[model samples]
Target: MDNFLIITCVHHFQKDGKFYGYGPFIREMNLWIKNRKKVTVLAPLIYSGIPGKIDLEYEHPHLNFKSVPAYHIQSWIARFKALFQVPYILLMIFWEMSKASHIHIRTPGNMGLLAMFVQILFPFKFKTIKYAGNWDPKSEQPHTYKIQRRLANSPFFTRNAKVLVYGNWADNSSNVVPFFTASYSETEIEPVRKSSLKEKIKLVFVGSIYSGKNPEVGIYLSKILKDKGIDFEFIYCGDGVMRPQMEELSIQLDLSENVKFLGNVTSAEIKSILKESHFLIFISKTEGWPKAVAEAMFWGCIPFTSPVSCVPEMVGNGERGVLLSTNPEEIYLALLPYIDDEELFQKTSKQAMDWSRKFTLEKFQKEIVNLECE
Candidate 1:
């Protein structure tokens, strides 16, 4: 029996005698442990609060969960408190590492950082590291993220492990594998019927309403489009700390009629929105794979996104989708041509869907199985 141990920083919750966590993360994990007889998860557990719309329950026959106290070092006080918890966290990881036959580490996180070091002590054990963050050598990131990236790329420390990262990087070791994530399966691919530009343009933003995701940029873009006398409707499909402020901004800008905020809807609802929408406005400052972009493209929604991470490659340097700029006017100018030209919009939409369909959940599962066998 394959004993699989997963170490992650994603917070899990227990409800009605079931384990739940962030929807997308949980979905991917379900695939990873599909064939394993025994599965152990080491993560933080939240004692209270109901699962959000995007939280999902884990579907495993035999699962063992080990809870670790969550800690962050973002502030001086936080750093001081985390100091005392280090020994306990390290000991927990080491004990789990000693028994597991196969270990999987989700990286660019506090728990993953510790597990990365612990796995080094068991070099002969088969392991896989999923670096679920920006792996670009030049991108600015937190100190701990950089450290995790360095360790993952070092063959000396990460032996007998496949380090799966979002994009292909030039400065990586032999074990570092370029990987892509998928939200939809081949069975979910359907013919998208999007409305023409002559009708009210339908734009959607499907991510966190936080600073890093740049949800405010979507509002600013809506203002630019409104000023240009372009009849449009902008929808936000996720929630965060900035939702209230963004809601107020919409009313203040007289965009309350044109903008709608649908806080944290189910995956099915998001797919339905993508099918009808003409464009996906996602100007996030950073991402690993940006599942939202891929999901949008899967539904024939052309994305207007920033040139961050592997997005340039995903968009084919403006062939499949528009690469955004910080300036709203510049973004407006770039977007106008696509809106005006039906041929260009249709062609680009097709290209985007074709590229995204190649990375479906079916293909992702096969890759995971192959990694385990290797």
Candidate 2:
């Protein structure tokens, strides 16, 4: 391919001539651009903001970033605005995708939904889509999300597109490819050893603190453990709208000594914390692939998560971690076994670590190279 163009939903901002957005998205896109001569990105450029702790940018020198209007489907007013804004964005997407040798779309977002529809006009173009949300065919989601999935899954409609999704489903379209995102380099892999039968267990929550991620559930679980006289420390490593609520509830539940909100931390700090912690909690309502769960597993931390989407597959159907019910009593029982048996704990940890380490950034890059060859 002569030119590689990526149209994504992730909002990127420019600062000091550098583009910044989500770190993991940028990392994966970096791999996608490795062998291309020219690269262009058509995304929202939020110009008035500084980079966050996890925000990063594309480092490609010959990069062209085309700015487009961002749209939201939240309120009536936003929807009214989107009626005018969405078409503009779609036209921009069509303009950019038309000039590319390859088209890559990142979902599930408003931009991705637009891209899915826009891409249909160019049926013969080479395209790849990373559907980075819940890929469960049975999961409940918004209408936009369902429409995006339907458009991408229809083999005839979304032709010449490799939809890289999180899990292996029973009857997916031929275009649907199972894919994984990476965090650490192969050289960064070290021997990690953790056991739950310690004097004090360290539990980590590594996602956003909001309703979608259900970060409050982690605090509630910790409170339940505390009330039962269990000795554990809850560490929240992300920030969101629910941080204030989590803080207030922790205080009300008398979990001051047990729960600690670390806010958004650096990748290195997160890695260090995971390496030391015995368990990682990710009881979310939905997910595509919980990258944090896999990252924690790579450091010998067992995943204590809901069986949503591909989580059961990622955690080996509760073989390498704890698959929990929404009920507090059931979750408590599921975790109780881990705190007593050292051998079982070590086995599970090792199983998780060995499985997760197989999908490093090096491997991810090679896979991209192979995809290019195809």
Best by the lDDT measure:
1
Error of 2 at 81 (Å): 1.6
- Mind giving the per-residue lDDT tens digits that candidate 2 earns over 78-103? 99999899888878888988889899
Q: Between which residue pairs do clashes occur in model 1?
A: none
Number of the predicted model whose TM-score against the real structure is largest:
1
Expressed as tens digits, the lDDT of each residue in 240-299 for candidate 1 is: 999999999999999998999999999999999999998998988889999999999998
**Shift of residue 297 alpha carbon in model 2, Å:** 0.5
| Model 2 CA deviation exceeding 4 Å by range | none
